[model samples]
Target: MTTTFGATSTTDEVLQGVDLSGKRVLVTGVSAGLGVETARTLAAHGAKVVGAARDLAKAERATSEARAGAANGGSLELIELDLASLKSVRACADALVADGRPFDVVIANAGVMRTPFGHTEDGFETQFGTNHLGHFVFVNRIASLIAPGGRLVNVSSAGHRYSDVDLDDPNFERTPYEPMVSYGRSKTANILFAVEFDRRHKSRGVRATALHPGGIPTELARHMEPGEIERMLEQINAQAATEGQPPFQWKTVSQGSATSVWAAFVGQADEVGGRYCENCHVSSVTDGTIGIISEGVRRYALDPEHAKALWAKSEEMVGERF
Candidate 1:
């Protein structure tokens, strides 16, 4: 059946009439926003949702609603994961693997947005290290634990349109550092990670994809200066106006998280595997300088050669081969 959903669809709407009994999902960033919403929907629909976060107390508080509303054998569990640190990432992955319970879906949703320049515990650029490399090491480490026909959903962003991954200088050592540039490179890496992961695992009945949750006013923007988001919205709206399009509207948490649910469960595996998605469907490739207002994936983000190169580079950086 063709999907009846669009940009305005909510998680509740997307999961309507669906039963997730026996499904097991792991969602990162469960402390707030899209992660909580995604886990809530999955658990409410009878799926066992394992939530990972850096802050256990915060996550326990944040996921109370999901735990309270859980139904039909559905439940939520929490595990500590500090994606900013390689030691933490590996430990988390190792513990999960040792448990031997297979996950039906793994959503790499935790990430940092535009922030003042810094490096992670491992000394990589903060955004790239936390958002991309961390998950890269974690997921690939536990890849064997994903059940056949499982899905890996990497939560990327529309900001990927801002730049492609610079394999030569991933740490901004030689180039000027812009917040969005780093964010873009990281988000693009998220997509490329999915592309290559899907390629390697699809033959085993595992499919991976990346998606943008649309713009939502969540804690992801806490690092931004006051008025930064507002100014960006104005610019987006101005660009939309010039293009004869509706003004850019921020998505509610539900609306923002709908696509993740769609891609994880509702969408066809064949259609979405190895693709970049937004607005509840696979995105078409497009070229533009509309900032984040552009509505499609860049071709380079899904290039097979690029994805392969990234995979190799990632292995080298992490000092581990998948």
Candidate 2:
């Protein structure tokens, strides 16, 4: 077993002594929460960080906050990117490519949870469309700009444990869309996307990994009802109330961002592609005591056949290839 960093591990803890000098990292959803923390930590470690967000104003604010928190070698740049729109993703990629600056890490940390039933401008369900399909196209379009040994960290969630992929009705066209199920499908897609991406690109010096950032009290909860949030916490506490139980808990933004930053800059993950990570470590594949995964890849998430099929279907939907 590898060193296990718990959900309390801070971003700086995971990145301690991991110098990213001269590395270029693009971090999406940097307007707040774990994304902002991840970007800040990377920048602090000497990476040239590009912060992507839907709103320029919010992006600027995030950059300012990061700068105020910068240590040695900290640098940040803001860029416009709305994952909800394929056109926006393409344009952002084009801009970066045209600039001739290569990225060493692309952290797909931005996502929406439990969005109402709707479709992207490209006509796909909101969660599957924005969270998975948008990122699908983004990664492919920007593949050339990702340098050898580069990392692509898809920031999935433990909520993925809730469900698996629905191949027949991925877009909910044939079936009614339930928010949680749609979110689960998209999260599952995030991991599979990494698995297939690594298979295709690892030899080219690019690697992809997916991560569950652990539960955090982040902006992600803004969409949930207050009662729902209370219920969620009550449920967690209820589980922890058992004798000899470790406390069921939530992470702060820094803690939640740790695994992602670790995947990006830690040497342990180098040459190790397509693994699912959490709590600043590679998560265990087995069902464990109290059902908490300590650290290996989930079999279902790593199913290569499913990944390939999803890739083809995604390309058909996006109207392009890597």
The TM-score leader among the candidates is: 1
lDDT of 1 at 254: 96
The TM-score of predicted model 2 comes to 0.92
- lDDT by residue (137-228, candidate 2, tens digit) is 88788888889878899998766665678877888988877888788889989999998998888898889999988877777767677699
User: Candidates' TM-scores?
Assistant: 0.98, 0.92
Query: Least lDDT summed over 10 consecutive residues: which range in candidate 1?
Result: 286-295
Off by over 4 Å in 1: none
Name the top lDDT candidate. 1
The positional error of residue 239 in candidate 1, measured at the CA in angstroms, is 0.5
Query: By summed lDDT, which 10 consecutive residues of candidate 2 come out lowest?
Result: 287-296
Mark the regions of model 2 whose C-alpha exceeds 4 Å error after superposition: 1-4, 240-244, 286-298
